[model samples]
Each structure stands twice: as C-alpha cells, then as structure tokens.
Target: MSNATNPTAEDAPPTTDEESVSVGTWLTVFGGVLGAFIAVLNIHITNASLKDIQGALSATLEEGSFISTAYLTAEVVIIPVTGWLAMVFGLRPYMLFNTVVFALTTLLCASAWSLESMLVFRTLAGLAGGTLIPLSFMLILTLLPPSKQAIGMGMFALTATQAPSIGPTLGGYLTEAFGWQSVFYLQIVPTGIMFLILFQGLKKTKPQLELLKNGDWFGILSMAVGLGAMIIVLEEGNRKDWLESDFILNGTLLAVTCLITFVVIELKRKDPFINLRLLARRNFLLSNLVGIILGLGLYGSVFIMPMFLAQIHGFNAMQIGLVMMWIGLPQLIVVPIVLRLMPHIDIRILLAFGAFIFGLSCLLNIHMTADYGHDHLIWPNIIRGLGMPFIMVPLNVIATAGLDKEDVGSASGLFNVLRNLGGAVGIAVLATFLSLRQQYHSSHIVENVSAYNPFTMERLQGFANHFGNLGADPILAQEQALRAIDAIARRESFIMAYNDCFYFMGAAFIVSLGFIALMKKPG
Candidate 1:
C-alpha cells in the first residue's frame, strides 16, 4: 500500500492521513473559520456606529456603553465551554443550532427600540456567535494533519488578525451608506452563507450523550461566572475608575475568587471541563503567553489608532476606516508568502522575527506630533500587517504540535480565552495610561505658561490680534486668545500621551520576545 494508507511508514508525518482529508472537510474547516471571523467582526463592528445608535435609542453615553459591554461579557463567558459542549452535542448540530441563533439574534438587534432591548439581543447574539471561535479551532486540529495545517492556520489567522482590523472600516462604511441599523443588517448575508456552507460541508455524527453524566458541572459554573465577571471588570474598569467604583471592586473580587476555585477544581478532576494541564507543556504554555502579547498588540492598536485619528484629526468614521484599511488589507498578500516560507525556516525564528517587526511598527509611532495624520500612519500600519501573518500561523502551529486529538478541544479553548482576555485587559490599560499621561503632560506644559512670561504674553497677543481681525471686540478677542493657547497646549499634551501609549505597546512586544525564547521548534 502507498504511504497514504500506511501508518507505519517512517517518513510519513505524525498526524491523520493527509489523503483522507477530503474536499468536504476543507470546506467545513474554512466555513467554520468564516463563522469565527463574523463572530469577532461583530465585537468591533458596532463600535464605529455606537454614537449614532445611542442617539437613535435616546440613551446617555454610559447606558449606551452596555451595548458593546454585554456582547463582550457574553462572548468571553462562552468561549471556554464551547469545546466540551460541541463534543456532547456533536459538532455539526451544535454549530448549526448556534449559527441560526446567532443570525436571528443579530437580526433582532437591528430592530431594538431602546438601550435595554439592544443589550438583551446583543448578549444573546454574543452567546450564540462565541461558540464559532473555539469550535473552528478544534475542527482544524482534528480534521487536518500536520502537513496541511498551515493552510488551515492561515484561514484562522484572518479571524484573529484581520477581523478586528476590518470591523470598524466595514461598520463605518455600512452605517454611513445605509444607516446605523445596517451594521446589524450586515450580518445577514455572511451568516446566510456560513449556515449554508456548514450545513452542506459538515458530516453528521451521533452525540456523545453519555459524556454528560461525567461532566464537570461545578467547574463549568465557576468558569462561566468567573470569566464573565472578569470580562466586565476589564471592559468597564477604566470608565468606572477601577476599584474606586463599588461595582468594579465587587466584580474584581468575584472574578478572582471564582477563577481560583475553578482552577483548583479542574486540577483535581478526572476529566476536567477544560484541561488546564495543557499549560504544563512548555511550548503550549509559552505560546499562550505569547498569545496574550499578540492580542494586546492586535486589539490595543486597533482601539487606539482610530481614537487618535478621530480625537486629534477629527476624522469621520469613513475617513478613519479608509486609513485602517492599510492595516487590514495587506495581510491578504502576506499570508501566502508567509505560508511558503514556513516550510523552509524554523517556526520559532519566524514568530520571533514577526514579534520584532511588530515591535518596530509600534515604536515607529512613538514620536508623533500634532501634525501627524493619514500619511504618517500608513507605513507603520502596513508593517504591522506584515508582522501579524508571520506570528499567527506559526504560533498556532507551534502551540498545537504533538498535542493529542483528545486534548485539542481544551487546548483550543485555553488558547483562545487567554488571547481574548489579554485584549480586554490591553484596551483598558492603554486607555487608562493615555488619560493619565495626557493629564501629566498637560499640567507640566501649563506650569510653564504664565501671564508673567514674556513669550507667553507675545503668543497671546498674536492669537488676540488674529481673532480681533475676525471682528471680535478687544476684550473678547483677548479671552478667545487665552482659550486658543490652552487648546493648543491640550492638543500637544494629547499627542505626547498618544506617543507614550505607542511606546508602552512597543516595549511590551519586545518584552514578549523573552517568552518566545522558551518555546521549542514546532515538531
């Protein structure tokens, strides 16, 4: 028999027989990856249109904030449990049911009449859609052997790296061209296609109903509550002033208590809900650690870059989207090239190189001025785009190398959960850092600007004369000039704060290189 059927062949790669990986299997894997893409897409897509949606619903900024917050909390809570649920229900049926629920809930979001209604529908949508991510990851490990897993990893990378990048761009364009409701409506076509692909591509299998009898129900409950509360604390902490707010303080304690309990329970269980033991493997543990840095860089940059453009340059949603496309679009070309190179180079080396390049991209923005705008960001964003594909595919490969099929689900869940948790933490930390830094810079600059200083007096006169030429009375022109100087100082402080945020991210990436050093070559 040929090597295809000969498991004993010494030269054959140590995985499932590649020849048995049928076209239908490929379709199912890619289709599920697409589902994951849509799931992540929904997280950021609404952000661009949030203000418009708030206006339509007549909600204050704080109340309207729950719209995204609810979805994120629900999504993070569901990710860890997805793998075990898929096994119990059977992957095909479990996936199809969630897809339909995701589609229907998203549609309901378009019709929400108030902030309360939107939060309910968004949380439901998140619960249903969140299953797609880990399930797609599990399918990849189970269905493909080592030889072809790179292609599958490339597709999955798009969900992790590209979806967030494209989300605001797509959301902004849809809301501008069609309306804020169209952001919800945008899900219809993609979900329809995903449902059809999943239905046709997936092969039916009997549910393992007996596994339910042995399920770690206590572990599941603790994990759900703990992760949910943790997500809320991360996403809302900065806004609520962290421990200063009773709500945030309580949530933090609850998260710490429950997550610790969950870990203890899993450590002692015979078949844990998620096998935390996977972290004992050096490469798997190191990769997940690196995954945190990747998430921080990916989601943190996406969060900050758009805010900078909007706050500083006063760019509209469409203009911000146009600028972000540079980061999102170049990966399409880079992925194929990275895949080609993976066979020749050491995966660890490639990953480190990617991290190095990504660090450089962040550092490139550390010297921003008030004049920095669209043109200044393109190369850095493009460099970011290049670096991501290198890290994503190789990182996934190294993490899963030599993992058993039985353990794939737990590993996938842990890997995805940590990365997402990192993202939530990154955004909160970056926002807080920016705010505090801006205040520091603003105060320092203001201390130097006194009415007693001659240069300050001269600059005030220049502003006053300019406003006086615009027909303001002398007293009013002088007041306007003072305000203008303050505004300029505030603007300069903001630019410095933005530079500090970028510097922090770059330094974090460089620090992550130490963790990458611990991982072995992919088997």
Candidate 2:
C-alpha cells in the first residue's frame, strides 16, 4: 500500500482499507533518525575533544572554543529561516540537499590541517546541520497522527536531547583512543547511509511559490547577522574582558541594534522569515520561554561538567565520557515512561516536579569539594537523568499542542532557534562566571597566607622538607614549596568557581519552576 499525503489528478484511487505503510515507510523513519543524530551529534561531539584539538592546532583556549561557538552561532542564525527555506525548496529536497552538504563538509573538516580551514568548514557544516532538528519535527507532524506523535517525538528526543551529553561520551573515547579527527570521520558512514535511504524512500512535494516570492529576504539577512554577532560577543566577551575591550563593546552594540531592527522589520513585513503570529498563542510563547530556560540549565551543566571532571577530578577523556554515559542512559529509559503517562497527568505538575529534581541535582554540585571523586558526582548526574525527560518531553508537547498544521513549521523553527540561542548564552555566562570566581577565590586564598603566619610557615616548611627528602637542594626545595602552594591555591580557586556555577544553576531551575506553574494544560 502507498502512503502518500497528496494524490495528484493522475494518481490511482485508494483501496477500501486505509493505506498500510510499506517497507519504505520504516526506511524513511530510520533515514530521518540517522540524519537527525548526525546533525545533533556534530554540535556536541567535539566538546570532549577540545583539549586535543587545541594542542594539535596550537590554538589558545579561547580560539579552540570557537569550534563550538562558531557552529552554534551559525546554527541559530539559520534555524529561524528553515520555515521560509522549506517553503521555497520543499521538505524532501531540502533535507536531501542538506544531508549531502553536511556529508561533504564533514569530510572537509576531517582533512582540514589548519585551525582557520577547520573553522570555515565547521561553519558551513553547521549551516546545513541547523535545519535538521526543526525539519525532523515538521516531518513527524506530517507523517504521524497526533496520538502517536508522543512516542515518535520521544524517539527523536533521544537523539535531540541526549546527543549533547552522549557526544562527549563517544567523542572522549574516540579522541583518546584515536585522535580528535576521528570524531568527524565516524559521522561519514552513518550520514552516507541516511543520504541513500532518504533519496530513495521519500517522495518530493514542492512548496508554494507564492509564499516564497513574498518572503522578506532583507529581514532574514539582518536576523542572521544580528544573531551571529550577538553569539560571538557572548562567547568571546570574557576572553576579551567584556566591555573593557573596544571590540566586545562595539560588537555588543551592533548586535543589539541589528537584532532590534530585525524584530521591527519582521513585525511590519507582510511575510516575515519567522511568522510572528504564532507567538500570539499563549502556550507557544510560554513554552518557548521555558525552552530557553531549559536550554540554559541543560547546556550550562553539560558544558561545565567536563571541565570539572578533567581539571579538578583529574580524569582522562575516556573516563569523563564513561561517567557521562550514566546520565544519558537513564533519559532513554525515562522518555518512554513519560510518553505513556503524559495523557493522564498534568504537564505543568510534571514539569514542576522535574524542575525540583533538577534543582536538587544542582544543589548536590554546590556541595562538591576539591577532594571529591567520580563516586561523589555520580548520584547528582543520575538525578539529572531522571529529571530531564519530564522537563523536555512535556514542555515539547505543551509548546506545539494547540498550533494548526500551517503554523507547525514556523513554530518549530522559532522554538529551536531560541533553544539554541539560550544554550549559547548559558555557556557564555557560565564561562565568564567561572573565570571571575576563580580569580576571586585565588586572591582570597593567597591573602590568607603570610610568612609570619604559623600555619602557613609550617605547611611551607613541611612541603620544603618533603621535596628535600626527594634529593632536591635546600633552595630548590623552597622554590618547589612555593610552586606547590600556588598549585593548591589554584585548585581551591577552581573548586570555589565550580561551586558558584552550581548555585547559579540551582537558582535558574527554581526560576523555571515558577514558569512551569504558569503553563496551562493542553486543551
């Protein structure tokens, strides 16, 4: 039986029974899932390999972070344009083109010898990868009935929500066992298979040409520049010392001006790149607000945890990855259960409960010490795993619950763009916070020690003696003791910074709980 949504004039009449799905249908699902996974994974897998990439490319810490910031910055800029792009090119063709482009760029990234070359290709890859998330949702809405969308969306969430965490896990092992480049190479095989299946199994449908002709091209361009600039400022501001640098101050001002202008133009234009009318819906607007907060907490925590494990806990890349698997695995189990219970339960209550658990997880991190090990961090991650499905799946359902079919694409596009933007902001804010707190704590620790202080003298003498016993000269032992004291100060400073980050996350989660309370049940 054929499973076509649109029947042309020359098409054969349907049989008495509703059209049964063909083998091609399952093929399309697999293809779509694979494509979605590749797109999502690319955004995050490089995270664990950042240190290796930096060393290999001879890049500064700030320059190396661009590998992530550049990709996400490009992604947010493109996401809002997906609805208009789809209307111009159609779903099947657009997805196929994107898949091909992504594959080609991945190969380029793998072979890139210089940091500059890799950054260029990574941005290109991101432009293509950006469309997959929203388009995945659009396709699911088109193919499945509302009743079954929960399960299908749950499966998609496994890729979308879980990939950020899982990427580091897979990437850690690959980076440690092979090299950072291996992560890009691993995507080629899966994405190639997806391209073949999608090209074969999916039918093409052209978008309305009238809609394309009416789109505001200027608005789209402005929005892209505005968002891209804003993300750059956010990601790089701390490294440049924020407003102290002329570059950051000017970039921030330009971003704000352009973004505000884009909003005004879009609101006034007849056919904006993103349909602002969808935001008029209460649930749609509120759910997206929650999505932003969710992105902040989720990505912020994920971004910081690797630093904690590797720097403070002294774990290797592979060990960091294995520890993170404990978080991702439970989400897969929890998503299915949440899908089954969603219909019977109030989504707001579920979200609140999830926020509470998530906040509790953050609170756990606040108590972490310099002496804490892998076992000390495991339970909090597990609680985080349990809290995630409730926040993610339910909020998603609530976001699009009341939208008409025509609005689905725009709503999905807007929601995804905001989500990505939230993550970018979260990472930027946390990085800046971490840096400031580290310096503050380090200064405080240093001020508390003096040559005349008995405890300080005793510790320094003890360290000098320990070094002397290892066959060092007296002067060398004294210098070594100073170095040891400095190392201890830096370690304590990092611990304080991490604690501050966790406390901020907990507060964000509490704020989310308030927002969740405002969410009304789906009609």
lDDT of 1 by residue, 164-256 (tens): 888888899999899999998888899999999888877676776777887889999999999999988888888999999999999999999
How well is each residue in 1-523 modelled by candidate 2, as lDDT tens digits? 0011221111111122233434555466567767777888997887778888888888888888898887878788888887667766667778889998888888898788888988999899999988777777666555555665666567776776688778888998898889888999999999889888877766766655665555687788789889989999988898899999999999999899889988888788665667777778887888888888778888898888888988987888788877777778889789988988888888788878888888889889997888777788888999988998888877777887866666667777888888878888988899999998999998899898889889999999999999999999999999999999889888989988999999998898898877777777888
Q: Best candidate per lDDT, number?
A: 1
Q: After superposing candidate 2, which stretches have Cα over 4 Å from the reference? A: 1-30, 54-62, 207-212
Question: Model 1 Cα displacement at 41 (Å)?
Answer: 0.6
Q: Write down the lDDT of every candidate, Cα atoms only.
A: 0.87, 0.80
TM-score of each: 0.96, 0.92
**Residue 443, model 1: Cα distance from true site in angstroms:** 1.5
- Separately for all candidates shown, the number of backbone clashes (residues 3 or more apart, or on different chains) is 0, 0
What global local distance difference test value does model 2 have?
0.80
In terms of lDDT, the poorest run of 10 residues in model 1 is 1-10
Runs in model 1 lying further than 4 Å from the true structure: 1-20
Can you give the lDDT of residue 477 in candidate 2?
100
